[model samples]
Each structure stands twice: as C-alpha cells, then as structure tokens.
Target: MADIIIKNVYVLTMDSYELTQGVVVIENGTITEVAESTEQDADQIIDAKGSVVMPGFVNTHTHAAMTLFRGYADDIPLDEWLKNYIWPAEEHLTDEDAYIGTKLACLEMIKSGTTSFADMYIHMNDVAQAVKDSGMRAALSYGLIDLGENRSADVELSKGKQFVLDWKGEAEGRIITMYGPHAPYTCSEGFLSKVKKEANHDRVGIHIHVLETESELNQMKQQYGMCSINLLDRLGFLGPDVLAAHCVWLSDDDIEILRGRGVHVSHNPVSNMKLASGVAPVPRMLDRGVNVSLGTDGCASNNNNLDMFEEMKTAALLHKVESLDPTVLPARQVLEMATTSGARALGIKSGVLREGYNADVIIVDMNKPHLTPVYDIHSHLVYSASGSDVSTTIVDGRILMQDYEVVCMDEQDVLDRARTAASGLVERAKF
Candidate 1:
C-alpha cells in the first residue's frame, strides 16, 4: 500500500512533454509512481478528475515575515521605502509579530499552490518555526547588515552563522539554511567576504540582493569605483552557491560575470515594477544561458501577495513589453521559470513530477469559466490561471490543501492572528 494516491488527473511532470491522464502514487514523502495507471492501493486516494497535477512553485527570494508590512508602505522608491518607512517599522516588530506574520505568509502561499520558498528576514527562528508548523518547505536565512549600526560586523555575522548552524537541515530536511547578507550598499566589503567564507565553510548557500535599483549601481560605482558585480567578483563572492535577487540594473559585462560564475538570479518582476526599480534583462540573461528563476520578493513590495501564478503572468507580460516582442517569453518558458528554474535556484528536487522525487505538487482546477476552453494547458496555466484555481497543494506527500480545503493549518485562526498582529504593529510603529 502507498501513503497516498491521486488519480484521474492530467499530470504535467515538467520533466518532459508527458502531459496525460495518469495516477501519481506517493510513499514515504516521495513520489513512487506517475503513469497512466497505478496498480497500487493507498491509505488515502484523491480523485481529481478535472484538474491538472504539476510541481508546485518555488519562490526563490522573499522576506516572509514582511507579510506584516504588506500595504504598509506602497508607491515609493526602494531607498525611501526602506530607509524611511520599512526600517523604522521593522524596529517595532517583536518575535511574536514575526511568527504570526510568517504563519500568515505560509498560509497564503500554501493556499496559492506554493509548497516551498526561500526566505530572508529578521527573527528567522520564528520564521522557521512558522514554516515548520505550516508544513511548508523553505530555505531560511537571517537578514544580516553591518553599516555603522550599533551591531558590529562580528556580532551580525555571528548571529547569521548561528542561524545557519541551528537550522541547516531542520524540519525533517524540509528547511535548508543559508547566510543572507542584506545587500552591497548595506554590508561592507569585509563583511561580505567574511559571510562568503562562512557560507563556504559551512557548505551552505548565500542569498543576497544585487543591484535592484539604479541607485545601488550608482552608489557602488561611487564608493568602490566599480559596479556591484565587479566588486563582488573581485571579492570572489560570486558562485553557484549564491542566490542573487533583482539584477535589474546589470550591464552586459555584469551578466557575463554572473553567468561565468554560475550564480542563480531570482527575478522579482512584480516587486521591481512596484518599487520603480528598473526592469531586469531576463531575456538577455536567458539568451546567455544564465539560470534565471522567478520570485515574488515579498508581500510589502508586490501588491501584498505571494501568488506565483500572478508572478508568472507578470513576468511573461513584463519582459515582452520591455523588449517590444510579444513572443519573447512564451507561456511554457515562464512556467519553467516559476517551477523548474526556481527549484534549481534553491537546489531542491520538487520542481518536476517524477518517480523518486519530492511530492511537492499542486492540482489546478481548470474547469472554471475563465479557463473554459483548454486549448493549451501551458498557455492557460501561465496566462489565464490564477492562484484561486489551485484546488489542492501537496508537499512532501502531505496534503496541505485538498479540494479547496486547507488541512495542514488553521486558516481562519491564522488570518485572525495576522489581523491582530498587524494592528499591534501599527500602534507600535505609530505609522
């Protein structure tokens, strides 16, 4: 007997053009079978007749606890938004606030078919706990910064290292740990180099922001007499273990550096557009064979949502318009960016539905009026389908949501706690 079996659904393995009527069998948190028919019985069987089963989305970059700051500061530049409002507001957040905020984020992501994510923020222990309790997979890191603040570089790096060591493979191997140095402008060169060394020493990955805005590019040139890419490269900090977010203001040379170093890029189109950060050259990066993945930075900068479906649609449309070519990012490629590319960025095995793979999957209901005529499944998924279309989300062979009902966590309780937390945060921040 298997642990669970899902039958009567169209399986989009994402490994190949294997979209067909099939049944998927799960056992021991892994996919045991995916084929036309399974002769196996399961303790729990799900008959998903009118849905398409595929890999769940992996968010490559996010500040999960920032869910508390969603809609709190909107329609502002990245610098002003962060320095004036967001940073000030963050000072008032308690551990309980971070916990509730992350729980809310996990609830939203699970409901929207996101089974895993990469999160960097303060109070990351609380964030990790929330992810564990919510039954989601995550790569977590403590946001590190050392720019003349009261916290010294050693202290900050020590804290980040503690986080990495404490949660390297926690949550039954569902949580991976990384060292998150906030960004180039925020952290000094010495600090970044130290962080890279620590990450390499621990054999973990490093997540950081790189040139999200023109201002950062300008600041780097002024301060270091070079671009952020060149400075980081000079420090030997660029590598496959680096997850760089928002390469919006990159030059051709910078893109080459990233590709040469085999660094992963997490393109947050929604957050970039919202913050007026320049658009990243995704087509150029893809054309150069760089592994460009998709991410919804955080709720605060992305219309207060973690819906990867919206992220997919926005990425497809944004790149096309920016390049003045409607055929730039096709539906299938955008879907890959959201699923396969993101998984690769996080070094996870959940992006493709295959035997012996992690059972991080979602069933999208295509029977809606909007998705009435299924001319092309890929097209419908990338261009037409929304997060609400997801009827089930399974992570590690566990049914987090089934038939539009969330089973892993209390949905209403999370929402209520989130509201209370947000209210208290507002009072504390006085904004």
Candidate 2:
C-alpha cells in the first residue's frame, strides 16, 4: 500500500519540460507512482489545494551549528570576521552547544523548505545527532585545520576518518560523511594529499573552501607558486566527488581546470557579498558546462537566515548585473542550481520528483498575493516567492513541516534553547 498520497497539485517534475496537475504516491520513502491521475489508497492523503509541488531545496555547503553565531559579528571584513570574532567564539562552542544550535538550524530549514544540506563544522557527532533527531538529510564533516602543526594535523585527520566510518551511511542512509580540509592556505600540501588518498580509499566525497577571496589567491601564489585551483589540481585533489565552495576569485585557467576536472562549485552569493569578496564567474562557469550549485554558507557570515529562495533570487540578479547581460542566468537555471545541481554536488538522489526517486519534496502555497497572476511558475518561484510561501516540506516520505508548522521537533523549545545558548556563548567568548 502507498504510505502517502499527494493529489490535486501542480507538479513540477524538474526532469523535463513537463508541468501538469498530477498525483504522487510515496511508499517506503520512495516515490512509487506519479501520474496525471491515481486511484491508490494510502495511510494519509495531502490535499495540496492546487499549490505547486517540487523537489526540496538542497544546500550544498553550510555550517549548520553556526546558527548560534548569527548576528554576533556583522559589518566586518572576512579576515577580521573569521580571525578576530568567529574563530575565537567558536573556541568556546561545546558539543552540547553544537547540538542545540544545529537543532535551531534544522527547524529554520524545515520551515523554509530545505530538506538536505552539507555542513562542515566542529562537534560533528552532535551535528549528526541533531540531524538524525530532526529527520533531515545532511552531509556532515569536521572542519580539519592543522595550522602547520604535525601533531594537530594527525589528530584532525584521524577524527575526520573516524567520522566517515561512524556516520557515512548512518541515520537510515540520510547522512553522508566527507573530508573537510579548511582551505588551501590553512592545510599544508602534505596534509591535503593525505586527505585525498583517504577519501579515495574510503570512496567518500570531499568538501573544502577554494578561492573565496583575492587575498587567498595572493597567499597561495607566494607560498606555493600557483593559484588555488591549480594547486588543488596538481595535488590530485580536484575530482567529480569534490564539492568546492566559493570559487569567487578564479581566473580563466581556473575555470578551465574546474571544467576539465568535473569538480562541482557551490556558489555562496550572500556570504560572498556580505564579506566584500568578489563575485564568482558563475556565468562563465555555466557557459563552460561546470556543475554550479547554490549555498547560504554559515549564519555568522550571512547574518540572517538560511533561505534558499533568497539565495536563488540573489544569485539570479547578481550575475545579470555583473555580466551586463540580463539573459545570463534565467529563473529555470537558478532553480536547477538550488535543486538538481545541488543534489549532484552532494551525490544524493533526492533533488528531482520522479518514479523511484527519494520522496524529498515541498509544496509552496500559490494562493498568495505575490504569487497571483503567475504567468510562468519558474519565474514566480525564482523572482517573486519567498521561503515563507512554503506550505509543506517532506524528506524521505516523511513530513517534517506542514502548513508552516514543523512536525519533527518542538519549534518554540528549539528557538528558546538556541537563544539561551547564543547568549551563553557570547558571554563566554567575551565579545
């Protein structure tokens, strides 16, 4: 029997040029059937009320537990923000703090229609537990930074590999583990090469920051005599299984190298702009057939929320203005960056609505004033709609949020705990 039935909705399959009023049947956490009509019986039926049903948003890169640091330090440059504020504050973050903060982030993501995210942060076991308890899908990694210390490097590498072994396919296959070398500047060449070898042996994906700022490029050149992209390529670190975040300072050769290596890029528009980092060459990358996805980064840098709708809008508009071409990144392409491309980057199978796909879906209320007069659904989704319009969010055939109410956890309790935790962290950090 079908576990859940969703009927009376406009289904955006996202696989092809087919948008129609249809029905979707979910059974055992996978889509069993999707058609224009259905007569199946199910445990529960979701009447979508003529709303739009599509795949849930995939956040390619983020620091989920950093929700506690949101709005703590803003209007500062990236270097100062990380060195003077974020790193010191993070030093005081305990495992319990990570749990509480990640719970808050999961609540916000559920309400905003994000089903899956890639997180690199401290206390990853706490983060993984939070994701498991909240019923959200995620790729978790411990941020590995050696700072040129051999002992610290050995400890960090061991922790990363242990995390992969312990949690790679845990939480009923909803959690994926990856190796997170902080960046080219922070991790030595030997450490990076060792990580690559381990990732190859374990067959897990790698998540790392790359070329996010001009200063990083200069440092790489002075230290290693190559750009970040070239350096990674030379170390045999660029591959299809790698998710490189923030390629904002790439040259043409860097673009070509990324395209050639099949490396995925997670463009963080809001964080880049907020930190005064230069814009990424997204249009050129797209033109070269690189798989470019979207991410909101951490809340400390973004300073507000993890809203993929806002990211989509910002991505679409920013590139057009930068390229002096309005037709550069259209609405459909931007939406794909949030959905299918992100799934591809994370190597997940839940970003499209089709038979046998994982039932990770969301319903957006279309009866709003802003969503009225919808000539093009894609355009309205990218240009007009906000995260508040999400009426339902489902992950792996389970409803996490319905009618703007999160079902997996206590909303008020999570918020209250997060508030208390953030205050305590600030006090301890003395910032």
lDDT of the candidates, in the order given: 0.93, 0.92
Task: Show model 1 residue runs off by greater than 4 Å.
Answer: 148-151
What TM-score would each prediction reach against the true structure?
0.99, 0.99
Best by lDDT: 1
List model 2 lDDT by residue over 287-335, tens digit each.
9999999999997788478999999999999999998999989999999
In candidate 2, where is summed lDDT lowest over 10 consecutive residues?
Answer: 13-22
Q: Write the per-residue lDDT of candidate 1 for residues 192-282, one digit (tens) a residue.
A: 9999999999999999999999999999999999999999999999999999999999999999999999999999999999999989999
> Between which residue pairs do clashes occur in model 2?
none
- Tell me how candidate 1 scores on lDDT: 0.93
Error of 2 at 152 (Å): 1.1
Model 2 residue 294 distance off true place after TM-score fit, in angstroms: 0.3
* lDDT over C-alpha atoms for residue 239 of model 1: 99
